[model samples]
Target: MPVTMPRMGNIHIPFKALFEGLGIDYIMPPPNTQRTMTLGTKHSPEGLCIPFKMTLGNLIEALELGADKLLVPGGYGICRLGYYFKTQAQILQDIGYSFEMIPVGVSERKFLGIMEIVRRLSNNAPWAKIVSSFRFGIAKMNALDNVERKVHRVRPVEAVRGTANRIYARAVAAIDRAPDYRGLKTAVSGSLAELDGVARNEARPMVVGITGEFYVVLEPFSNLDVENELGKLGVEVRRSTFISEWMKFSLFLNPLGINEKKRVQRAAAPYLNRDIGGDGWESVGEKVLHAGKYDGIVHLAPFTCMPEIIAQNIMPHTEEQIPVLTILCDEQLAKPGMLTRLEAFVDLLERKRRVAAGTAKAN
Candidate 1:
């Protein structure tokens, strides 16, 4: 099987590392682009969320490029994501697109389930090799995310615009070529060091925490690259979810009794009494946890994403008092319009900060 999976941010970096280390044959389709979106939208059922359409598009593009085996991550949850792989496969079959789907149901079996998926991809490679590849893959994932964290901080504070992004691009390239865990670490360190070398502004940027549906948070194209735009406006961006953290919870920690799910559930408290599907529960908890540390929170979700829509509605009712902005995204969103909304939000935050400072001084 020539394995190919949908692209979400830099997920392919670690995915490639894992497959190669296990001697599994894999192919990555071209990076997601407008062409991919257009194709997906054309074939997609109306009213489906953007993530569904996007991943369906990714699979179709990969198949057209000679990919025979497709891997689409799956889960069992209240969200429609549980049905994504099945539905996408059926859609392709209906359209006469010949391909095989290796659906990895993560939510149902968690780590053990993923192991089964990895086993299939590994082509019966020795268990030792499989374990080793998993280790290396996870290390690369953490390395990539750590570099991203530094880039986020540097972006808002850099004296020269685009410096952080340039360094970040280099880091990603290095990560892709890294041969082992050690090389991945070195690549990450070198990238962060370069980012640190960028000259910084005197004033501290307002920290903004972002939370919402997982796909929209990670895929820049879906969210119109909100983080970069925020950085340009001098706002530090912190994500509510990263692949490294999510993997830790879902794969390693949960099975080992080091889970953080309970803590997040507790934080969410009365606002969301139960899992409302997707990352809705976590979105609420992330706000509560970061309320004191961040100046504001932005909830980005796909159009009609029920979990995030529920989370967004509950946000204004939270007692945390942190300002919240909800941005619903789709193919129709324009960059200029998104930027204008962002600028208005930034202005509001700045005014609130100034007013708070003045009141503190008066007291």
Candidate 2:
């Protein structure tokens, strides 16, 4: 089986599609786990983000499962990620795994180049067929990305408990189980079908834009299911990053490049003076501006996330006339209470907006 490395979030859709499209049987490592953490930390260079270490461990675990090949992407610049791929490969080799390593996007090459190599190595498919397969995979990926974005954006709206979120959860499940191009496209579009009846004005829930460390924002477990709870309470939600944005970052690699540290610095500059952590600034700016456009800002962070904490502190100073909530969670947060607080926060924002509107009318 081809051993695929776990992606940072849901961004690995295209390559997953390409593999299945070629009929290359692959086993995806389970989402990062404690075992994965131990393996990564045991092997990876110190000082890397925990996520990177876990991903490396994920690959190693997959190798132990008898996967013949490992699929990883090589970045071009900024953030230490550009260097991570090569170092990880060397580490794996030192551990004596005789598996083929496929690195996508080396030296700023087009993604098509990556697909071409995958085609040549994974299967002996003709060049034309490989390109066609890649396109189909990309199409499905784009559709799936669209649904995820829509669900995330609508999460802050107050709705019946577990209503919209349940549908999205199912949709995400569908995407995960999708077996081919057709299945993927259906899964992507079907997610939106559940939201057809939601009226935007039925609930004037407060909007909360979430920003922080990439993994913190992307992974639900890490963020304590913040999006799901916010939606149940009728708060509209926005996230600073998505699979689509990552594609843009991958394709352009500047302005949209893989510069997490610089992006965070830039985003937090309105609140702080410089870049504090890798790739956190842009997300900081996005959250503040998004919160202003909506009703509030909620920055999700793991405990001790320095850059994000700094950004969280700076956010309240933004002249956006919005409420700011900084939620720090680790493995010990209470689920039900977190939901309650989100509901109450949305309620407060709704009341404030109505009062402000009324006062403006009277004036």
Candidate 3:
């Protein structure tokens, strides 16, 4: 069965592990490239979030490569995401591309229903084997999540620029190629070693803590190549929220009746609150926390995202001690201009940091 999935930043590692463990053969669409964007825009409905456009593009690419099935999650709640699977399926069917869709969004009863189907499709594979595969997938996913947490710490360090990244890519490749759980575990562990000697901020640059909606933060193109642009400007970027963090939060912290927006607000409580929009409370709070540690806070969002709008409005009041650059992006973003702006921002922050250092030295 040909499998397909969405592209999230640095997420290829775990996804590849999961599919490989299931012994599924699938092809990932090319990296979120310009062509992918073009295809997505051409086919996607107008006025959707940048993420929807990019995802449509990814699906188009995969379909063109002869994949026979698409794997997308069906979300729930008041979120627009809850309807993505059905909508996307209808859209693709209308476009004349026929493929089986394996959407994984179901209630507990439905989940059991789906599991039975999966078991039947698996030709009644040994239950223990399936459980073992699941365990291995979860372990490898954890390893990959750990790698992301640690790799983000590599900033302003004078080391081989892409060494950690290269090792990560190799590890993913190894996992994708591994035929069993043991092989997958070894490959994942080996990739973790690739991060050794990766340095942290010794001579710190303009560090910015980025937090926002999951799809916005995880998908690079949706945010105008955020981390890469910041890194190019000699800025060390740290993301406060991640896929794994979100998952864990849901399992533990979510029991308190907090949604994603509320969680961010709580995380940023020491900062400020504004009449802003969406997760404004949280963004402001994070800015407050990172004020002296980093140069600024970048509140990223899709053009019309409500939570980020809330965060953006309140961010200014989050203690003007540190600047906040609230960037709202869409499909029409200009990459070069984005890079230039980042360079200028980092330059300004670096100058400020140096002046602060000199004043302390004089004292």
- Candidates 1 and 2 compared: the better one by TM-score is 1
lDDT of 1 by residue, 1-363 (tens): 688999999999888988888788888877888887887888888799999988888888888878889988777789999888888988899989888898888778877787778887776778888888888888888888999999989999898899999999999999889997678778888888898789998977999998899999999988989999999999999988899988888766565676666687789987888999998998898888788999999899899899988888888888888999889988887899999999999999999999999999999
Candidate 2 per-residue C-alpha lDDT over 190-283 given as tens digits, one digit per residue, 9 for 90 to 100 = 7787665544445555667776767767766556668777766666677766655655555445563466434645655666565554445665
Clashes of 1: 0
lDDT of 2 at 328: 69
Each prediction's TM-score versus the true structure: 0.97, 0.74, 0.79
Alpha carbon deviation, residue 257, candidate 1 (Å): 5.2
Q: What's the distance in Å from true for residue 119, model 2?
A: 3.7
Best by lDDT: 1
Candidate 3 structure quality by residue, lDDT tens digits, 107-175 = 333434444544544566666766566555556666666666555555345365766556656765676
Q: What is each predicted model's overall lDDT from 0 to 1?
A: 0.87, 0.67, 0.67
- For candidate 2, report its TM-score: 0.74
lDDT of 3 at 53: 76
